[model samples]
Target: MNVPKASEKECIILTISGRVQGIGYRRSAQQKAESLGLTGWVANLENGDVRMVAEGTPDQVDALELWCRNSGPRMARIDRVEVVRQQASGVFVGFVIR
Candidate 1:
């Protein structure tokens, strides 16, 4: 098993389902993540879901997650949000849409 260093930032993978595609979900998420000083990527899945990987301070990640769960783009009708926490990779430079 890979142990995370105590100094490492927190990371999370969010899977959002329902009416998330073609509605600027990725763009909105990217902007939000950037605003929170997070580094990661958001992308559309073939199964009509949106996936986002984010790394930042715990507070920052939590804020972003709350935004995603409580409020998203005006056009997005999110039905569910699943979050998986993981060790931060320290590889991303900035948030991006993919």
Candidate 2:
């Protein structure tokens, strides 16, 4: 994917479903986000979904999405990914597994 020259940070909320729980999805997501210089947190939902809130440049966000789709984890089987863009808020310091 082509990296976009982003001037401002972007916020995105990603909802991942399908065999997300009990896998290393959250850890992998946190590592991926941190490597891309993103700030966010990842958590497992009660309904067997994984939720992530991330903030970074468009390119970084796109990379994270691509990684999630391609290789979430060994035990994860991603069926769907829902992403929503929102106004950026520079509140988080680093990516974390929650």
Candidate 3:
């Protein structure tokens, strides 16, 4: 029950699975994060998973996570989404595919 304040900046690291690679996932996620006014990066993992790190307000982060769990990249099948809340690193400029 640790709800963050509306304007409190936060960060989250998400690991998404299931057909996440080669489906424009990284690009799509990058776009999504940017559209939500977030700063972060998305990349493909070696174990066939997608990793995303987003920094923004709590609501914004939650929104992005919801999208990732439900309807990810257009042609992607998301089976699971692992989320980790972490300290915001005030370093990201924009979302990138890395």
Q: What TM-score, computed on C-alpha atoms, does each candidate reach?
A: 0.91, 0.89, 0.89
Relative to the true structure, candidate 3 has a C-alpha RMSD (angstroms) of 4.5
For 1-98, candidate 3 gives per-residue lDDT tens digits of 76444247899999999999987888888888999988988888999999999999888999999999888767999889999998788788878889
Q: How does candidate 2 score on lDDT?
A: 0.86
Query: lDDT (CA) for every model shown?
Result: 0.90, 0.86, 0.88
For model 3, name the residue pairs that clash: none
Per-residue lDDT over 14-95 for candidate 1, one digit per residue giving the tens place of the 0 to 100 score? 9999899988889999999999889999999999999999998888899999999988899999899999998788888889
Tens-place lDDT per residue, model 2, 15-60, is 9989988878898888889888899899999999999999888888
* Candidate 2 clashing pairs, residues 3+ apart or interchain: none
In terms of lDDT, the best-performing candidate is 1
List ranges where model 2 is wrong by over 4 Å.
1-7
